[model samples]
Target: MVTGGKSLKKFHDVVAPADAAPIRTSYFIVIFGSAHLLLSQLPNFNSITVVSLAAAVMSLSYSTIAWVASLEHRRHGGSSHVVDYSMTASTSAGRTFNFLSALGDVAFAYAGHNVVLEIQATIPSTPGKPSKKPMWLGVMVAYLVVAVCYLPVAFVGYYVFGNAVDDNILITLEKPRWLIAAANMFVVVHVIGSYQIYAMPVFDMLETFLVKKLRFHPGWPLRLIARSLYVVFTMIVGIAIPFFGGLLGFFGGFAFAPTTYFLPCIMWLIIMKPKKFGFSWCTNWICIIIGVLLSLLAPIGGLRSIIINAKTYKFFS
Candidate 1:
């Protein structure tokens, strides 16, 4: 939602610069949340197939535009901005913290792992045709797509903009105004689907707790109230503290690194019991160590960044 707001702002800046008064991001967040109130009502994961598909396409489209336009900018010498590849931070401590936070950002990119099981659950499985087969294929294809979408944007964008780039590459590109505007809209659409994908699991957990533990009667009323409340709570929080990069770094390392990086490897080791000091054992151990370190260190940097930003930020402004 925050990203969508930024995109909308970028679009507004392009289309109506004369009348583009500075709007608070919170308003855009509310608009984004309002759309989700309707989308969150979708019954289950399978029901959102079309939305998910469109989001995936939008992601690819915007990502492609980001890098391609970056290359064009560099090639055309669009700006006199000197591309400096040096460290963005001035001090050692700042550099270290930024480095750690960057690791969290990288970890955040793999956050789709959190919903893998839920998505697989939606797939049909039979004795003769297990779901894992198709799931594995899908996972491989998804990873390939991620690699394609992410790598060029990361490498080429940095190459072009260097350390001066914004947290969002789209924000840094200026010329080709219409294209940038379109890319921002694509980002908005993509994040809408991404938000729903991440929220579906939380919704399920909330509904389960209410139905099983609290003994709420299972019906549309329960779902409506529970899901609406969940959306509103998140919306309120977003409005309150919409620190995009900081939040990504914090949650990425705090929540995602364990599940995405190490937990699966640990589970494999425990279930398969690979021979001690063997390749699989050693690899998994290495992964665990790295993931553990990421989980421990990244949040500190993220928190520090949030503090630094919060010092200047106005509440809901």
Candidate 2:
């Protein structure tokens, strides 16, 4: 929610500053609520799959343009907007907090590991050999392609805009107005698709829980109302705290460290039953320790970023 809101905010800030000021909580809730309600009308997951594919293509197009543009900018000797790339904390504690928040943003950016299993389930396998080959190959290819797409864009965008780069890279490209507009449209399409993909699982879980608790199997009307309410809830929360990097940082550090890193280490240790103080045990323990430390520290950074940014934003805004 935070990330999406931030992306929207950045787009408005960069592309249409004159009409940006009224981008407050009410506006976000109305627009996002309408979008979610419309998307929720889809009958099933298969529809979402189609949307996700379209999103992938659109995202790829814009990302490629941004990546190439950054390289071109650097080649032309355009000065970078970022002055420092060191790991050390900048002068202020708030800057250090924002830095950690940025780390969370990076974590969110690479967070597809959890979805691989979901994706694997979609691939068909033959009976005889129980061919997991396709699944493995698909996952490998996807990750490889993502890495190829992301690395150059990140490196070049940072090289070109440095610290000045907005959270959404496409916003940095102001030239070639038609292309930029097209890229922004792609961004909107991708965001809509990606939003459905991410939110559907959450919506399903909530609906299931509600059905159980309320002791009623909701018909389509009730289901629609329930999901629409959830969407509104998300929009309200996003409106309240619209700090994009901070939310990414907090969720990444606080949630992903456990799900992505810490839990796996513990699971391996338990399942393998490695000897205490042995190499396997030591490595697992080390990972757990690091994960715990990161989980503790990352949220603090996220919180600070939120605090700093919140001062400038109206609660309704």
Candidate 3:
């Protein structure tokens, strides 16, 4: 809302296709797959594994359809609506109401996620023209509409079921057997589709690292090992441990912290003290500050995550 969607979308090109290569597709798959595996193990959602998987698969199918449509529009040498946005969420810990109130955490994530999107959007489009506006506006509007849609669903769900509306909104409102069946169907389809989408970045990264950086021959042991290790890591995290808090916090703190807390502070510091250090002096200060905050919050966040879980569900031993 602070910035126009047009202004916002021009930021995606920040991550160059070449530079993004090392990220490895296997890592993404493992992470999402692991998340599925982890969530599946949870008492509430464990039974819904098949449904969740189906949801992920649906996401993939939707993405394919969307991508093909995009290609078609591209060939037409005109334009179409493509809304891109990013989201940030608490690690398995959720928001620690003590250190950062849920309000603060949510605001931080929203802002940080936006910055990531900005960086990603920095890539140039075609030769001369930048990406367009109506498309961006449509995205912004749709986000609002979706939010609007959610409000009614939230009210109806809570009013109808009280505390039953717990971790997942659907779980509360799903009173009918047929609805449960349909929901399960949707979930499995969604998981496959979404997993494939997240896997792309990891895939591109691993491929680039192997082919270009390490110069490993096709199907070489190194490449094979990398893929195998990545897959194993995914399963370990996805199934064995399934810790969301650490993963969420690590990325949120490392990536989002710089963009949100540090960047603005650095920008302010630069204007305030440009000649003091002569090189990203403000940014350096921000980095140090963030380091200190994260250091302090790391243990705090961890403890808070545990306490919060204890308070809510006796899932812990």
Candidate 4:
């Protein structure tokens, strides 16, 4: 719930919801990728710093991907007009079961993440509202800045640990136990923040059900009731799932198959006319290919570990 809240809220906005889903997903990818850039070299994240770090990251990704997607749309014969429309992909039996193999999950997860917003991101606009600020140039510049910041850090991290790499930065730093503890603390806090931000809407979803179906009034007392139920839901996930890392490892790895890697380029392809598939299209295709490759490898790792390590996977294991 905590991570969900922060993540959800970071991308959350009911008013201009069309942008929310892709923005949220891209936010995760940008942060995830940026953290990797620093992994080999840099100082660890403290609470305050990570907040700023993530914000800049979110901005960069939101801008960069938005620009690239827009450019793709424009080149494809649509005006670079953008709008926020929400869409969801199926996660049930039909398309769901075939995605079970970690290999399968890779395909699914990748597909799912992509599916989360594939329809909207590449679609051209209706000719109505004035466009918002142009983010591509600014965001492109930001990615360059972030990349410069990250490259050195990755090497440093590698230097700190050669063959015997620790699981986290803190574990490797002998004297700086504080750094280790602080980084963990930031991540924990961030997770909580993301959950609250993300799942709060899920709570509202539940609340509406309660108020409408159960005949509760949609006021303070109802809100409290809804919140309490939401809290209970959190407890269940925490207790039942215990740690979500393996779960995310499995799920994130799982979703990566369809979502993180495959879907965007595919969507672009669908909307793209031949004249549009020029240099950037080729670049994105390479990236999509690389991501798909990595995503494929990841699911195998996840499935093996998920099957053996995760008791939760016993149903499948």
Candidate 5:
């Protein structure tokens, strides 16, 4: 959310006249968070279908804009800025850490696995016609779309800018001001939906704890207060840190990698009891080993990056 808002501000600054005052980074984050305050009130995942669909479209739109614009920029020799393919980090250790952090980023990009079961629950099912069949098809299609959206952007953005690209590619592309601004806006919209998607599960857990563990009455009042508080807490954290790449690497590894990479495989091994040393068993074990390594190593790089950035960062700035 903070990154999206910051990118939007950067878009404005890019197109604004030289005399225009620079926007404060914190204010836009607050504005972005405010949108979620209302959105969080949505009762459940099923209710946000339209929002989710819009978000998906916006994601594809911005990704297309990013790579396409980057390709055009490269062809036109858009700027005098030198593109260096060399390592950005000065030391070997730094380079190693960056590689680990990149793994976490890959984990994060596929973190949709965290919500897969919940999404499947929403699908209609029966004894003869199982939800898994449809859910599997949907998951496959979603991954295909993800590949389409991600590959071009990663390749073209890196090709055009090398190590000089901003974490958000829209911010790096300065020409075709209107297009970039629109892409940033698309980012904001996509993030709005994404925030809800990720948060819905957390909201469910919170509400469940309140009702079952604490015996709080299950009602709107409880929902309103709990959900709103969650939104506020996340918003404050986002504003305080506002280190986009570092956060992605950190949470992506520490939190998401297990769920995305290994947990399901573990669950399958336990539930399905795949024959030991067989193809299914071997593949799952391989994934588990890789995911565990990612979980252990990626956060070190991410936290180090965060600490480095924090040395020069100001709260809410």
Candidate 6:
């Protein structure tokens, strides 16, 4: 998320000033340095909720702009736009790797179902019967939102940019500086807010371990120091290797596949105690097998992409 914010800022900086130099260490140093100050002020969970809501609003706006722009570009016969939606032709190994990488991308898009349970936990249940209505409602709403936001942009952007699309779609839209800048600005804000939301769990775990296991005092000083260090470490890592898509692919396949697909099946079996060799049991096992295979194999393509990209990129270039 930090890398995303940095990339968008770099995008804005490059176009605004028409700078020819590549994004440098100084840019990241300044950005992350400023980020430290921003994060330091966000002390508690309640404060971050407002940030998250703000991010959601920005995200909705940006997504709408992207979808609309993509359609307009394609409809108006923009340069580089093509009707060829056929398979990408390449060597067998390359094709297979690209397919795997695409799977990872899909996984990344669809991941975060686990968060539904977390959100559901906060919703009030009925007095007598445990209400699953709220949870399912949330899931349905989330999926609908994802589909609405993703499908049009993915289809129309591909139709417009074809194989020439940048990793960041906003970068591909060169015209209408005000629109692109607005979209990128929101991208930065949304990512910054999202970084906090995602990282808060890790912070909670680390602080719990420190205070309980290591006997550290549970105070603002320790919290500030630990959280600051964590933020710095993440920024350093982001600066060192700026491969967002590859990282998404790797994590989506290796971690999210299991969390989203396999673990749920296992949990279902344990909870329901279904027939040992029933149809439901067999289906769950098949899902588990597929999930396991995806987790093991899909990351290969992501790793390969990382290596290939790394060769052309300097430490901060």
In terms of lDDT, which candidate is stronger, 4 or 6? 6
After superposing candidate 4, which stretches have Cα over 4 Å from the reference? 1-133, 137-153, 177-180, 193-249, 276-288, 308-317
The parts of candidate 5 lying over 4 Å away from their true place are none
Highest TM-score model number = 5
CA lDDT of each prediction against the hidden true structure: 0.88, 0.71, 0.41, 0.42, 0.89, 0.73
Alpha-carbon shift of residue 171 in model 1 (angstroms): 1.3
Runs of candidate 6 with Cα error greater than 4 angstroms are 19-33, 40-46, 80-89, 129-131
lDDT tens digits by residue: candidate 4, 120-226 = 23334455632222234434554467565334434444443433432232233332233333333344344433333334435556777988898987776666555
Tens digit per residue, CA lDDT, model 3, 1-317: 00111111112112235355343323433434444433322222233445545654543443333333334433554233342222233453343433443223332333322322332354355545545454466446545643454445444443433442332333222223343334433433454433333333454467678888878775545544665555455554443322344334444444445555556656657576666666767556756686547534644554454455446542211
lDDT of 2 by residue, 223-303 (tens): 788778877787787778876667778877887667666787898888989999999999989988877877778888988
Model 3 ranges off by over 4 Å: 1-124, 132-135, 138-142, 145-164, 172-174, 211-213, 218-232, 242-303, 306-317
Candidate 1 matches the true fold with a TM-score of: 0.96
Task: Show the colliding residue pairs in model 1.
Answer: none
Highest lDDT among the candidates is held by which one? 5
lDDT of 1: 0.88
Each candidate's number of clashing pairs is 0, 1, 50, 51, 0, 0
Please tell me which model should have the higher lDDT, number 2 or number 4: 2
Which stretches of model 1 miss by more than 4 angstroms?
none
lDDT digits (tens) for residues 221-285 of candidate 5:
99999999998898888888888888888989999999899999999999999899999999999
Q: What is the TM-score of each candidate against the true structure?
A: 0.96, 0.80, 0.43, 0.43, 0.97, 0.87
Q: Tell me the TM-score of model 6.
A: 0.87
- In candidate 2, the residue pairs with backbone N, CA or C atoms under 3 Å apart (3 or more residues apart, or in different chains) clash, namely 82-163
List residue ranges in candidate 2 displaced over 4 A: 1-29, 74-89, 121-133, 265-287
The local lDDT score (0 to 100) that residue 312 gets in candidate 3 is 51
lDDT of 1 by residue, 123-187 (tens): 99999999999999999999899999999999998899888888899988876999998999899
Candidate 4 local lDDT, residue 5: 26
